[model samples]
Target: MSELPAGLHDDQTNSEPIVTAHSFLVQQADLEREAAEVLPGKFDECTYDKGYIRQPLYACLTCTHPPSNYQRTKPDASAETAPAGMCYSCSIECHTGHEVIELFAKREFQCDCGTARLLPAGEGSCCELKSTRKMLAKFANTKNSYNHNFWGFYCRCDTFYNPDDEAVMIQCFICNDWYHDRCIGKAPDEGDYEDYICRECVAKHDVLRCIDTTLVFRGVVADGVDRQVEVVDAEENKAENTEERPSKKAKTSACRLLPDTVSQPMDLFMVDGWKNDICTCTGCIKKIETQKLEFLLDSDEIVEPEMDDTRGESLYESAMKKLQGMDRTRAVDAASAYHAMSIKLKEYLRPFASAGKVVTQQDISKFFDEQKQQTH
Candidate 1:
């Protein structure tokens, strides 16, 4: 028979499939044997400790070894102690195993080596020996400043340099230069009295006191810019008055004069003859007529007649009828009232274009055609 591959016999070389099956069975057996050696003892008697048992498995999970003695001596005194359930052997990994047992007994059952343990719910535990060593090494390697006074009170000075209760320091108003409070005859109590008044008050005293008059309708000069009020020269005042007097005369003549169509006898008498004649132009006449119409429209008497019989008619209807029969002056007044009403109605209709009511060119042409036909 032909020799099979290395480590195989001719009978075993039936096929590659047969060889693989045998190898898998051998692997399964080896795994089962290794598992039996590492797993916990099934029987109660087999589980008993060879040495003294400090903690139950469940409780041991929650209990950590005490922190190293060195961490206990920290200034803050808030060091975290070694937690429980961490295996000492896993933590130290010493080759001799002697150091492992010694640390295990010293740290109690809390060390990682002595027993298998479960982590308790919400409890963080660690091996004492390794954790303590880490803590000690951390403390040894760290450098702390000796110059600081960690408990000192905070200072309000700009430099923030802590000073004793009576130490004199210069107080500044605007510039950075300091004056010793005692030397300047100023008290520390004065500077400490307010938070923001020092530099501001000295620079702009007037602004500090100037009361806002928008709400009260009365203002007070608490603080304003420092300014000198110069005395007025009598000669200069007289010259200013002379210049202002002529402008006043010119303004009165231009703004106060009324056209003859609207002016009363008193107004006519008040204006110069030349102005009265010049005011009779067509433009002046139209302005006068328009004002007269506006006056009638605004007058309650025109709308609310004294007679009860005419009061029931609409103002526009009654005014139109009045215009048809009135003299030139009253006709102008009534027509002006109608014109004003039309203008107002046009303004009211203008916004309707924005609300999908725009009048197109065709609509305008149609409206004008209808009006022309009605006139005929």
Candidate 2:
């Protein structure tokens, strides 16, 4: 077996040992008996078993130990003197160190074998020790209560008022913090207390408060207003940074064919393959590419022709040729042909007006009257 350190000993032999292993066994048995006496059934015989002695010592001494290491030393005693009693466990000199002694004194308890134990117990152990323990327990309970009562370490006045009885807690949508209605300066006893007020409400309040100079001096709206203003300023700055100039292609593509003269203007004109052409705009481009594929998947069906300018033009041209070949009253035939042409022109211009073309009603009426006079 390894030899014990100089000051430490494991010796089992002694003619008359000042302190023996069995002494601690006896002391522990006595302590258990005392404890059982105070509170019946509180401690049993097995409580003083070897397992109990081996546990870490929680109590400290109130005085210093002697040099001999067998007993506690008096305050005025020198290192040459032997100690009165020794701690069975730690094997250190019996005088409780500063920390251990202080804990026992403050707690109003004494270690089983120490000079410090001589100090008179304050208010007695039953009152002082038990009260101290109760106070510590209450403090721990208060800390736990504070934790459970306040959510996210924040509580509104209303929430703190009836913390134990609140059925449903309201949480802010933004910031996700909880508050009582009364905390925000609102009456808690009012109807419909179930409503939740969030950071958004504060933000809106600040915005309104900022715009009103009266509320600005109160400082209540400053934080909220500043946040909202910062957001608006940031958005504006981003929009300015991302501003883009129109491309040359877009400007050139906007040009269109215009009328050469009012008399022979092309009222109805169509691009030959406009439906097949690909659109260039971002929104239209996607559909443009897939249009042909979509058309093929759903075969096109021919529908009956409606009376339109294109149909009117073909009918009027044939009628004019037949009118010019007629031999009886050529004047009347010319007059009738002119009237038919006027009606055809009106039909063509009507479609343009309906389509949002820039043609005035006055212009259409004037043109029709001129054509009628020419036929007469």
Candidate 3:
């Protein structure tokens, strides 16, 4: 047995095969548990009608290729297909076979799947599009924003994100784009901050500069080190995000809370609960109002992991809970039988482990068949 994938036991000699099978079982169970923790909700219903709630989104690369980013691409004379995002149900149903990139959750976005922007109901359109359709939009949702993340890229480096990579990426609270710590600039590894305003968002919204240095760690490189903005500049009406970019008149007339000496936009790693410290004095209130900065003070603007009573329970836990609810005598008898069967199954698999052979579903079935034969 050469080197195994990261989590496998290393001390195997003759028992490598059995150990490998055991490791596989453990890994599978762990994966199930992790998935349950992250996504416990039923993804049966289309979310388009809910209207701009924060929800997990997937980029259907099958329909639109990334800046060469996610999933299987449809061949074309042009690679300029506009990026479109789908909801969880659309990802599984409408674009099942396509290479998809999980974008996690985006705030205030409606699913573009089966809409005129993605693939409408027509010949060679998305499968199941007609079945569970949200009323097709005539155009892309102007309110929905796009970044390189929609195209399966992240950070200022425009690197395609590999989830397995060891590099840590943090999401900017404002734009919701991820950034590697090193790409943004040097900062302390152990520093505590939950709300990060990326350099681009910071540049677009100059009011963030007024955040006290004592409450935030600035990801400031040299004055000339340029961080590229993935989306259009404020000069254009194109939506990167409606909130972050301001019109010319609003920009010049907005509250000037910062000192005249501080001119450039830089990353602000805002400490948790720093929102409470924002000035509410008469002058600052005018600035907040001018810039539509009331959301800054609103704690509801913060995104948190979603939970509901409808979340599904894992099979193992459901079974265990059922067993617990039974009378004591019945529970003990069932547990004992389960333990004995488990032991026998392990024994049957022992030879394979010792021989360094792989155990398949058929092997487990054969063991059960032998047990049935003995019982007969």
Backbone clashes in model 2: 7
Measured by TM-score, the strongest candidate is 3
Candidates 1 and 2 compared by lDDT, better number = 2
Candidate 3 on 121-218: residue-level lDDT in tens? 34544434444454564556777878778878888877878879887888887677888876776543344554777878777664566654323356
Model 3 clashes, total count:
2
Quote the positional error of residue 14 for candidate 2 in Å.
Answer: 44
Best first by lDDT, ranked: 3, 2, 1
Error of 2 at 86 (Å): 52
Tell me the spans in candidate 3 whose CA falls farther than 4 Å from its real position.
1-38, 67-79, 120-134, 137-139, 189-191, 223-260, 279-294, 299-376
> What's the CA error at residue 45 for candidate 2, in Å?
49
Least well predicted 10-residue stretch by lDDT in candidate 2? 101-110
TM-scores for every candidate against the unseen true structure: 0.14, 0.14, 0.57
Give the per-residue lDDT of model 2 (tens digit) for 1-376.
3442222244445343333334444676666556434323211111111211211122222333233332323343543322111122211222224323111001111223312222212323312222233332122111111121111123433222234754444444222345543333322222212223343333432211122111111112222232121112223333443444344123223322222222210111111221222223443333323432223113233221122232222334646666667886985968877788867775756654455443444655887797779779
Q: Would you give me the overall lDDT of model 3? A: 0.63
lDDT for 320 (candidate 3): 86
